[model samples]
Target: MSVLVYTESEQNKFKKAAFEVASYAKAVASQLGTTVTAVVINAEDTSELGNYGVDKVLKVSNSALDNFSAKTYASVLTEAAQSENAQVVILSSSADSKYLAPLLAIGLNAGYASNVVAAPLSTSPFKVKRSAFTNKAFEVTEIQSETKIIGVSNNSF
Candidate 1:
């Protein structure tokens, strides 16, 4: 299975967060011995994702998805993850991604973690270290689910 990164874009252009998530996912993929696949919606160009070590890009440009809907976007990401056999799903901690992360986790029945500051401590049990209480403290979460979802905090990398 590969690592899937949900890339957020607007006006047919990718945001900086997209690249960050892609780069993060690439590092995680390297640790997991898998490739990175980026899932983008309505992006005009996905070639730039390769610069972040994204091995593949899944671009969904459906007109119905032109507008942002958390539920709809989560569903699309879930489907893309399943199709890609994604063992790990990474997203930036943007407002939109925060809304989508939990929905996508529920859809995929995967364990979810937010504000992750670094790579996973372990992948077998899917242990991750994340910031808690607004970065005042830290928490190590162990995810037993087969798939794992991570939301990277803004500018935390």
Candidate 2:
């Protein structure tokens, strides 16, 4: 199974968080012994993702997705993850990602971990370290589901 990452963009240009997530995905993919696949929505260029260790890029262009609708974005990501057979899905901790995370998790029937500060600690039991209580504390969470969704904190990687 591959590791899937959502690369967020604005005005057809990828945001900084996109690269951060891509890098984080690369680390996760290495731990999982798989490649990294990035999904870009309405982006103009995706070649730079390769520099961040993205193995494959899926570019999706649709006017209907120009506006940010949590439901619509979640649907698209869900489809990409399933098609890629992604066991782990990575997202940046942007506001839009936070909105989309739960929807995507429910759609994929995966466990959701937000504010992740680092790459997974273990892949067998699917454990990750995440920040809690406004980053004042940290917690180790184990996702029992076959599919896992991790929202990496901005600049954490």
lDDT of each: 0.91, 0.95
What CA root-mean-square deviation does each model show from the true structure? 0.9, 0.6
Q: Give the TM-score of candidate 1.
A: 0.96
Runs of candidate 1 exceeding 4 Å displacement? none
lDDT of 2 by residue, 1-157 (tens): 7999999999999999999999999999999889999999999889999999999999999999999999999999999999999989999999999999999999999999999999999999899999999999999999999999999998889
> Least lDDT summed over 10 consecutive residues: which range in candidate 1?
119-128
Using lDDT, give the best candidate's number.
2
Query: Model 1 residue 4 lDDT?
Result: 98
What is candidate 1's lDDT per residue for 21-106, written digit by digit as tens?
Answer: 99999889998999999998998889999999999888898889888999999999999999999979999999999999999999
